[model samples]
Target: MSYTPLVDAEGFAAFPAPAKLNLFLHIVGRRADGYHLLESIFQLVDAHDTVWLRVRDDGQIVHHNPMPNVPAETDLTVRAAKLLQTATGVSYGVDIRVDKRLPMGGGMGGGSSDAATVLLALNRLWHVNWQRQALMDLGLQLGADVPFFIFGRNALVEGIGEIMTPIETEATDFVVLHPPVHVPTPAIFGDPELTRNTPSLKVSLLEGTADWRVLRNDLESVAVRKYPQIAQHIQWLSQYAPARMTGSGSCVFAAFVAKDVEKNTSQNQANAVIFGLPKEMSGFVTSSLQEHQLLGFASD
Candidate 1:
């Protein structure tokens, strides 16, 4: 079923911040600024962390429930609201409460997505009325993946996550396994043995001629070397389908393509896989999202 935002009787609007899976990540090059140039198809999924927002007239952004160890000032949702208020000089603030569901450091883009949702939801809540691209530009300042969530569609992302081109992806279900480990992104990217010379396939991807199944994440090898549990999860899931690590590390997924005659075929396959998972492993079944739930919150 499609997702939607909801408002409670107390006037708190709950906005869904959906997670994302990197179908295939390639490190094509690195810039002089030490930022790695990447090419990946970012697929939106149904797994979400809800951000409940209520406008405040006092012009003070407050986070009612911050994630453990993450201060409210550092929390992406709070930061996003503050950023918007500062950028637009809107004499308004918000109370933020995030129902954190996605795993931390699992490469699921949870924090980034929450930040994006705040930016989208508050644009209207505060009547900022900034165009979507402007908000996307603002989102880039928050996190690389934040802009893509604001972009709000399955996209061929490139250029350190700023460039995005919408791409058509078939509906599919994925069983995402989050290994119990927090991968430090810098360590993985700093590994000397990490591959950084994958050829760019931007042309093929845009032309719709690329065979994505054969493509792979270049960072997987580095991440697996540092965290063997990730490799173990990938190995276990691969037995069911062609499994791979998404984004940096920790979370791995195997896709189940949908069938025409059986509408529930993919979900069933995912459910069975999750049901049979080893007790030590943890994961959930989620389908591809055609667009972000707040895609219409901002105008193009």
Candidate 2:
């Protein structure tokens, strides 16, 4: 299919690749392939990385600012663009630039979101016009989290991150902290004690009256145990509200409802802890997104 690239006055376009929170993540089972079956509520947030794209007619994927030590071929954004080019045989290339905001290894789905953004943006920029399902199928080969970003909603995600049921969640304010550490996802999942048998949540229970706190990240125990700083940070945030680790670890978050996310300081109880965060720690407040910025780019 031929497509006219959505070039602007400058001949380029930019898109947002937002971060996500596993509002609650659980491991319900394991597959024989060594992939853990999961049940989680994935919430999109305003925290995002900006991806800049300029279409190239010659079909060469180039990263204007490739990550340090990571080849353009190795980066997810470039990989996504190349994957689309390969799959569709589109005689188009792209120049990719990223204004990265989310931290690496923070379990925030930053890379996956960036990749999804590339696919969605390039689909328009290159005019491939492939269906959303096709793009998501391609994204899965990149990472488990990539599909959720493409799925484009707060979702009830399961089955090793493949199955998804869209769910409505109240937009919430969250204070997210970056623990001065990195948590390896494989190590957390590989721990013998990691809970792989947590009971599944029925849609009725999840959509009904079940509190979010009822479900917790099964990987939390493994993460906090390996890095006491994770637990310590969670404990500190717990002083204001129930705090939980998002994804595997290294970043923890607490919800805040009673105060302004931007204006609140340590003077008020709701934000006291957020603004009074330890000097050794750094974090920012963000509100949950009801839907992904790319939701309409793909048809469900």
Candidate 2 RMSD to the correct structure: 3.7
Tens-place lDDT digits, model 2, residues 62-100: 899988999888999988998989999999989898989
Task: Report lDDT per candidate.
Answer: 0.92, 0.85
All-Cα superposition RMSD per candidate: 1.5, 3.7
Q: Count the backbone clashes (under 3 Å) in each candidate.
A: 0, 0
Model 2 regions lying over 4 Å from their true place: 1-10, 258-272
Alpha carbon deviation, residue 63, candidate 1 (Å): 0.6
Global CA lDDT computed for model 2: 0.85
90: Cα error in model 2, Å: 0.5
Q: Please, what are the lDDT tens digits per residue for candidate 1 over residues 22-80?
A: 99999999999999999999999999999999999999998998878888899889889
